[model samples]
Target: MALVFVALRVLLGGFFALTGAAKLWPLSAPESEQMKALFVQFAEVFPLKLFGYQPDPMNYQTTVGWLELLAGLLMALGPPILQEISNLFLTLLMMGAIFTLACLKECLSTCIPAIICLGLLRLLDICQSLVQTKKVGRYCRKKSVLKKPWEQRVSSCQL
Candidate 1:
């Protein structure tokens, strides 16, 4: 199970890192205008426009891209808690991606990545809880065993 979690985390992190880097391409290339135009179109067509929060397309791209990049790195190499936090942020981003695709009437296949990531995150949560539970049980058992000998010694000294 731990192996599975590690494998999934690596795969998901790599995917996000690549995707986010692609999104950031406009930041340092001649394609900035074209990419901005495409993102503008996307923002216009997606559900965000319906909420009266029309953000500048470039800002949106930069924010999401950098967030994805950071989160991906954390998920890949950080401690378990940080990995979980990154997973949550990535999950939210994926949900937004899925929602946009749905709003555009994209094929169901377009949502598969987000769905898979969500599933992996849930599984990670469950596996982490199980691992923690086992650790606690082991600690309790050890503590009880150690306490018995100490108590016996103390009583013998008192006598």
Candidate 2:
């Protein structure tokens, strides 16, 4: 189960990292124009307006791209606690993306990538919780066994 989580983390991390970099492509690059156009189109569905001030579409796109890139890297290489936090950020980003696609009346096929990413994130979360719970339960049971006078007191925790 832990191996599964690592594999999922790498998959999700690599995927988002590549996508985030794509969104932040160089100004003269063709991909840059496409990403900018995408944000403009999505803004029509939900103007990204918070309060009374509206942010520039390109800025919003850049901010999101930066976040995705940072969070993806953290998810891949950070400590366990940081990994969880990064996962939370990524989960929110994916949710927003799916909402955007839905607002645009996109077909199911078009939304599949975001949906799949969201699912994998969810599965990773569940697996993490289960692993933690299992460890705690196992520790308690082992502690009880080790309390006997005849048995050696040994502690082993291997992930």
Clashing residue pairs in candidate 2 are none
Q: Go through the candidates in order and give each one's C-alpha lDDT.
A: 0.79, 0.82
TM-score of candidate 2 against the unseen true structure: 0.80
How many residue pairs clash in each candidate at the backbone level? 0, 0
* Residue 101 of model 1, lDDT score: 69
After superposition of all CA atoms, the RMSD between model 1 and the true structure is: 4.6
lDDT of 1 by residue, 13-65 (tens): 87787778878864556577776776776576656677777778888888888
Best by TM-score: 2
lDDT of 2 by residue, 1-159 (tens): 668779889878888887788778755667677778888877766535555556578887888889888889888888889889988999998898899899898999989999999999988888888888998988787544344543333423221
Model 2 regions lying over 4 Å from their true place: 26-28, 47-53, 142-159
* Ten-residue region with minimum lDDT total, candidate 2: 150-159
Alpha carbon deviation, residue 32, candidate 1 (Å): 6.3
